[model samples]
Target: MAALNLTPSDTSTFMLMGIPGLEAAHIWISIPFSMFYMISLLGNFMVLFVVGKEQTLHQPMYLLICMLALTDIGTSTSIVPKALCIFWLNLKGITVCACLTQMFLLHTVTAMHSAILVTMAFDRYIAICNPLRYATVLTNVRIAKLGLVGLIRAILFVLPLPLLLTRLPFCANRIILHNPFCDHMAVLKLSCGDTTFDGIYGLVVSFIIIGSDLMLIALSYGLIIRAVLRISSKTAHQKPLNTCTAHICVILISYTPFLFTALTYRFGQGIAPHVHIILADLNFLVPPMLNPIIYGVKTKELRDKVGKYTSRR
Candidate 1:
């Protein structure tokens, strides 16, 4: 890699890569990617539209669903369109500022999505374990506050990432990123400067945010499980557990690919670059496409409303 003097300027641009080994199949590869993006948009938008139109669905749980839907839309929009452009049109030149902005939006929206999941877990816990105080605990104002806090927390944690990247002088000859989007680690690797602090900060922030949120969600479910088990009636246990099924599915889909990709990056050096890139892409792609579908299948009210709308259409 030849070193060239480059700073974060308008002329500095990074070339985004599609699947490294599958460059020949970029067009073929985009078929499903495009489908997933479209499905994510349509499904999440339908969720928001349904929630908005039906006054009866304006409860804490549905409101949280709306939040998740918005974040899902954000997550998909932040990355997929650019990815599709690279895949289909071969338009891969992204300026340093644009790449940094994309990186920031990608991470912030992801953090917000994780927080929404935590909020949903809390919602389930309250509805099941503290049924009497559910309404009092999670009013519309409170939900709005929670969403605001999630946004602020996301911005606070992710705001420094682009700033950190800006300080690192990138190798002028090595501006081609091997992934579809401007990922934090991918961008960090391009920097010629000592990235020890930046890398450590990124990891620490990720652990603190993801680890703490996971723990909170686990604790919430643990309590919910304990509360359900204390019930004397076996038949009564099903309803509470059923409500959580959709959320659990969402959590698995949202986190599983992310954890797998993170672990692969640290441990799986032999993994193909294309494979890693695909997994990384799927981390952002899969959840938004599946979340609403899972909820529609598992949630009766949402399913009924969707059915009514489709039948009428």
Candidate 2:
């Protein structure tokens, strides 16, 4: 069915509601998001620096961590700054191309993240389950292959979603995006033509592309846990588990809300506009906050290393 663009009737649009109940809720939202933007920049840049500087961490695991941190940086930077600008400044107006570009980069990077998780899962699986094969499996050649695969897979799957979105016809009401960012479903809702194709294409991307990536990650962890159990020494088992723990936790937190948002849009409450808004914030804000804490704080090597690296005169 064709999605109706929001006319004057459907919009009590609290998109730029300023604040929830306070005097300047706009400033309130902008403040926290601004703080988050800074933290994301600092945390991820520290991660990149440590990984780059310390030759001891020149292994595949740290390399992947660097890449993951970079992805988090991209993910947060892609959406949050524009959102803060719209909220704090009076820059509420985004063009069709800008909106499409924002949505495209957001999803493209997100897709890369999911694929990276899949690759990291394999890395953990090999390091634990097939110790002898770990080096061969995740060699620089193979890592290069995985990186190329992730880049290509993300572009191949998610680029179409936004390209399809641009084909949508907008009526007179192309003004404010319901969410601060040019969210895919939110933008699709503005389409003057049938949104069925966009919705179907997005659903396929979600379930087949991202969902499949999650499943493979889970399977890798399954084999890993099995391998850990088969090991005789408890400490050895825990070592591998310890490394995988942060990644697994980040993956779960990052993904669950996104899938919930998708479900809420397609099958759950018909009020996608509000649910979408809340989930959009969570999807953007929560991960940037969570990634540093969950991933960085886990290992003493990273903690002490970053601590010393930053504390330098």
Candidate 3:
């Protein structure tokens, strides 16, 4: 299948017919997506209820998990319902304002989502590397502050992308986004204005949110591994090291596809729209659907806590 290469300005709307014979693919994708919606919402909502109800789980790590769960919920909320709506129902018309709103929140939430994961890594790192100071460092007040910082980072990172897009002159071709929701670079390309500034902004924000977060997560682990090696008790050290396993897995699951989509959308538009569409759709949907389940399945404490909590009711 050849890629559809329409910019946001050039094609106001994307018809399902553009992709040749694969219309059934959208239906197939919808089945998995609807299943994801149930699990993603239920799983994250359970985490919120558990952490909120249990004071024993009030530590920094659980606090961070709560935040991650919320992001998982929010990220899924930002993209999936709309995508499902378009895919299953064949509803494709989106106004310029509506599209930009989707793009803005999608970028902001995703950027913040990654930032919080990086912060969670740092929290785990500190808990492992410097046990005595963990309580002092990651106070409830501090966690709240970090939450604030994450929001600020999202706003700062994603604001420019849409702001640049708004300035562009929209030609009359605005129709439907081929995918369910807004694709930032995909939508941005449709602009009649010079998108150089938006492109530059997107790159800078990518490096800031994606690149910086990746480095921070790595550095935190480096310090963590060093501290883990110094512990004398096998049992004592094992528990701390085990706590980090979930964060590490979440980072891999969340970031790799994220960076892939961002890079591809920015750099790979010339390739084919079909390829870009897959990357873009997977980017928003997978993290939300998978992260909570992965954390629940992998982390014993979370599993036991959630299990006990569920059974009690």
TM-score of 3: 0.87
Which residue pairs in model 2 clash with each other? 18-25, 18-26, 19-25
Residue 120 error for model 1, in Å?
A: 0.7
Every model's TM-score: 0.95, 0.87, 0.87
| Cα lDDT over the full model 3 | 0.75
Name the runs in model 1 displaced over 4 angstroms: 1-11
How far in Å is the alpha carbon of 86 misplaced in model 2?
1.4
The sequence of per-residue lDDT tens digits that candidate 2 reaches over residues 1-313 is 1112323333322132222333256776677788878888888888888878988877787777777787888888888877776666645555567777888888888888888788888888887778898877787667767877898888888888778866766655554445777767777877689989889888788788776987898899888888789889987777888878888788888888887876776677666464556566768777866787676788678887888877894
Q: CA shift at 265, candidate 2, in angstroms? A: 4.6
Task: Provide C-alpha RMSD values for all models, in order.
Answer: 3.4, 5.1, 4.6
Worst 10 residues of 3 by lDDT: 12-21
Give the candidate number with the greatest lDDT.
Answer: 1
Clashing pairs in 1: none
lDDT of 1: 0.89
